[model samples]
Target: MIQRRQGGFTLIEVLIALLVLAIGLLGMASLSMTSLQSNQGAYLRGQASMLAYDYVERMRGNSAQALLATSPYVISLTSGSTRNNPDCRTKTVGCSASELANQDIFDWWGNLQAAIPGSGVTVTKANTNEYQVVISWTESDAQQHSTGSQTQNFTLRVNL
Candidate 1:
């Protein structure tokens, strides 16, 4: 009788296959991690935008009151990783309620430390007899964050 050879993979072949699979899995895992982080960043931004809108709506609703109030409404603010004056207790001056309301709203949106409002713009041709509310926050590297403020504006139209 003739002896027949068994048709099967050798131990070395199986080990090599497993090693390749492991490497591929590692690569895939890293890619997934990066994608998750990007998604999280986008979610945070969306929340920030919603926060901005909330403040804008409040300003719109309280246009007459804000315009006639003795002081401005101070929203809250933060600069990415920078430390902030939460209450502005150190100084006699603080942001008005309407001025920084969007920022304060931003603070409530996520884990970010603060949401600061940048003094910029007015009610341009976009809306007549409306005071524009502008809010901004730093969200990147500290050095570049100042220039990289995430801003949103809304108009509070009042019949003056």
Candidate 2:
């Protein structure tokens, strides 16, 4: 009598195939997690860059006070302090340069604190028409893990 061979895979073959599939899925999951973390870090960095640029523009608009040695433009805020309102937002009346500077700084600082975690900013005069805007903030979890630095800084030089 002739016997017919089964046309199905053995139990061991099925188990091996399942094991390979599981490993591939695990690898894909790890890759996706890393991509998400990197994207978050990039987003935070972009926010920091924009904040620094905004601060520079504020100083440029109030160039008079910005050039003064003891100008409000040359200020630093890192402790997340609550600033008082500058009270110069009325469109009917005009504000002096110094008052405008105060308003700008107050508004900018408030924005920084609200937008960035552990944020700090410093504006220093480099020359007669050149100034440096330095902004610092805490990095996201992925950045901290990869770079070993908890904080990051962005600097901009403006000439008014």
Candidate 3:
């Protein structure tokens, strides 16, 4: 009589191993996706901040014609600001609004649609001829597991 040797892994053992592996793989996948998304958000936010600061720099070096304009809300880009992309003709001051608008920074911001896509900038003129350049964009903080946004500002108080 040949005896049957019961030397094999039970069904329960196989199932349990599979379950643990699946859970581990799922956790790793989720972590990878989250990391990718965070990187993208950070990149966008950085670009937005640089754009805002670029505007502030332009304003600091602004020409008297644009700065001293009667209009409190100086939005030259709305007008024929990009009509002329003249050379850096300013000897000791900023370029005219027209020239400034033709700069790369304005071009990067797309159009005067009144808002930056996936972001927003508020160029507020404050006391003592100061300018508050605020840039905002959405991002997720993994530690908090919260979905929200943030605002970064580059304050430039003109020497008036």
Candidate 4:
């Protein structure tokens, strides 16, 4: 008597293969998520850098007040602080150095908040001609194991 042999995967073998594929797909999905979070963090960092540089440029433009012993540009702003947008643009004679600094800060803070929500800023005089600007914000895409959203900061030091 001759017996017929089947040369195909068994039910158990197919099920095991499918399980492995599912696990691999899950791993790929997890990697994609991590990549997205890293990209978002990087984008926020870039925005912070741009904002800091913008402030630096503003300070440069108003170097008279920016280089003062007690610079008007030196300020610390909380995330919830209400900003005042002075209409320095309407001044034909041009605003004072302090007024320019205030307007600059107002515009910078507004851009920072618009770009990255829940953001705060601090500008400190590091030296007679140097300043340190720090931009801080909360990242919503932080790890799931953390107690809350992670706070990230970008600092830029400039010398005029």
lDDT, each prediction: 0.46, 0.80, 0.53, 0.87
Candidate 1's C-alpha runs over 4 A off are 65-76, 79-160
Per residue, candidate 1 scores C-alpha lDDT tens digits across 1-160 of 9999997999999999999999999989867766765564565556555554555565555565445443233333334433233553344686555435434443443332333332222222223334443434323322232435333333343332
Higher-TM-score candidate of 2 and 3: 2
**Candidates ranked by TM-score, best first?**
4, 2, 3, 1
Each prediction's TM-score versus the true structure: 0.47, 0.80, 0.60, 0.89
lDDT by residue (tens digit), candidate 4, 62-115? 899889998889999988887787879987988877888889888888888899
lDDT of 3: 0.53
**Comparing 1 and 4 by TM-score, which wins?**
4
Ranking by lDDT: 4, 2, 3, 1
lDDT of 2 by residue, 1-160 (tens): 9999888998999999999999999989878877897786777778878888888888878877888877778877776567777688675687888888888988888888877767888888877878888888765455334645466788888788
Q: How does candidate 1 score on lDDT?
A: 0.46
lDDT tens readout by residue for model 3, 1-160: 9999998999999999999999999999889977987787667656655666556555555544235534232332322233333444443676656555445345434542234454554555555455555555445565455675454333333433
lDDT winner, 1 or 3: 3
Pairs that collide, model 4:
none
User: What would you estimate as the lDDT of candidate 4?
Assistant: 0.87
